[model samples]
Target: MYYIGIDLGTSAVKLLLMDEKGTVHKVVSKEYPICFPHPGWSEQSPEDWYAQSIEGIRELTADCEKEMVAGIGCGGQMHGLVALDDQDRVIRPAILWNDGRTAKQTEDLNQRIGKETLSKYTANIAFAGFTAPKLLWMREEEPENFARIEKIMLPKDYLSYCLSGVHCTDYSDASGTLLLDVEHKCWSREMLEICGVSEKQLPKLYESYEVVGTLKPELARGLGLSADVKIVAGAGDNAAAAVGTGTVGDGKCNISLGTSGTIFISSRKFGVDAHNALHSFAHADGHYHLMGCMLSAAACNKWWMEEILKTEDYAGEQAGIHKLGENQVFYLPYLMGERSPHNDPDARACFIGMSMDTGREEMTQAVLEGVAFALRDSLEVAKSLGIHLERTKICGGGAKSALWKRIIANVMNLKVDVIASEEGPGLGGAILAAVGCGEFADVEEAAAKLVRVVDTVEPEPELAAKYEERYAKFRKLYPALKETF
Candidate 1:
């Protein structure tokens, strides 16, 4: 049987087709526009997501046997608010994860309500991008629309509801909403009251690999697939990517260096840091994982290489960066504001320790090293919780760079494992679908069979020591500039 995996991303929806044997048949991507009505705000139409996902699926399976498609699953951008009215129409454009318009609401939650109390209820503290904060922003800024909300859905859950005609979300995705009691795997009534949302407003929660409902008869017929095709409650993009890379079970780690960077560590037992710096959320594999996300990662490099340098040759620019961890210049990778340990939306990117002799190569190396040091900041938080990781599976577009991989490996002092297939969330969504269809016993089993490690980047002692010193100085720059930002 065949399975379909949909990665509902910020910029586009990528669809993938796979069979029971873990072979990818086809892949199709459809891009959509992101709206920025004001500075630091991001929005997208849910209608666009649905239309393009449908179109992409048709193209992805055009030459294949559509009737053989047994299940469908989605891994999507987390924390985007997709409100619906009683008639099931989108109430407004979705507030994206990169949106930073909820500074006031986030401050109220973290200060007035208190982080300790919030963490006790939901195992997370409020960040500007969290769904609960967006709800509060809507209530205050758009009262008329807030009064009409019949359901509050995450970005991907909106797609699942459209396909299955079931309002549902998985634990891993729900955990990002700051409305879930992650330790207990249920909705937090306290957070519901705080957000002025009710229990009925939320979708029913399921584990990532559990079946939510079947494909709607109309949708299935129009798309040339079976009506009985199961739609599993899929995962958050990071969690799905972790499963795709076989970073399941205790002590396993996965580092994603996409537009945003993250360090995800899976654990069999529940754990939360005192500062709540790292997100303690349920995993796609039916366990818990701690994640630290930085809003800007490879994006910093993109800005330097494309916008500043006026060139698209990322390899050519990176090829000039030969020396690792020895550059005197330093950069702060806070271009889109920061998350993770800092949690400061006002934080801005800048270069420090530049001199007359500082060249493009030094600035480029700093951009790369800056992101690595920031990732290490979160890894330090995990280590504080007594979680020691010596190796991590790496994925995403940034992972394609050998220099970046070597920098990350040495800077974090961990072995970086490169997988043969770097499909990330799309592959993970298909694995979840296969597991839900009983093609495998569970998520971990499916992952073990599908994920393959092809190479390893080991940290050099000398390079690690040099980065260790550089990281110490990098950590101090953010605090020094926090008041100014």
Candidate 2:
């Protein structure tokens, strides 16, 4: 049997086909426009996502026997607000996860409602990118639209509804919505009232591997598949990536350094940081995980290498960055404000401690080191909660860089294991589909068989000592600039 995995990303929808043995048969990607109505606001049409996904799926499985396709799953961008009217038509363009228009609303929730109370109800503090704050912003800014809202959904759940005719979301995705009682794995009534919405307005929640329903007959016909193809409730992007890397079970860690960076740690027992800096969310593997997210990761390098430096050769630029932790120059990777630990949206990126003799390689090294240091900030929070990580499985675009992986290993003082297949969430979704179809016994069993570590980057004692000193200084820079930022 074959399984299909749809990754509904911010810029495009990527479809993947994998057989029972975990061999990738084909992959297809379709792009769509991301609209910026204002300076900091990002939006996309739900219609665009559905159109592109349908077209991409047809292309992905063109050569396969369509009847052999047993199941479909999706791993998608989380926290985007998609509203529907009484007739089930899209009410407005989706407010994206990167959208920052809800700064005021986030502040209001943290202040007026109190962070302690909010965390008690939702196991998370309000953030500008969270769905509940965006809903609150919609209510205040567009009262007419708010009144017309018959249902509210996340980005991928909208696609799930279009395919399965079932309004449902997975636990990992719902954990970020600020409407879920994450510790209890249910909708929080207090949070529902605070957002001025009801439980009926929300989609039914499911575990990531649970089969939501079969694809709609019309959708199945259009895609040249049978109506019996099951659709599994997939996870949020980060959680899905964690599953793909086999970062399941207790004390396992996965670090993703994509456009945004995240440090995800899985735990058998529920745990929340004292500061609520790290997100305490239910994992797709039916356990719990704490995540620390940084808004900018490889993106800072992209900006420097492409926009500022006027070059597209990322590997060439990184070729000369041989010296690890001895560079004098330091950079703060906050290009798009920040999320985990600091949680300050006004924080700006900076290149500090640069000398007149600072070379191009030194500046490049600083960018890499800066991101590692910021990841360490979150690791410190996890440590405060007594979650000690000795090693982590690494994934994402930035994880492709050998130097970056080595730097991360030393800077965090943990072994960084490189997976054999690094397709992240999309591949994970396919694995979930395979499990849902009974090809595997359970998530952990499927992961243990599928996830392979090709190489391990061990932290050198000398390099780790140097990075420890540098990290101490890097941690102070944020506090020093906090008052001004």
Cα lDDT tens digits for candidate 1, 180-215: 999999999999999899999999999999999999
The Cα local distance difference test for each model comes to 0.93, 0.90
lDDT of 1 at 183: 99
Clash number for each model: 0, 0
Show the lowest summed lDDT stretch of 10 residues, model 2: 420-429
Q: Could you say which candidate leads in lDDT?
A: 1
* lDDT of residue 41 for candidate 2: 80
TM-score list, all predictions: 0.98, 0.97
Candidate number of the best TM-score:
1
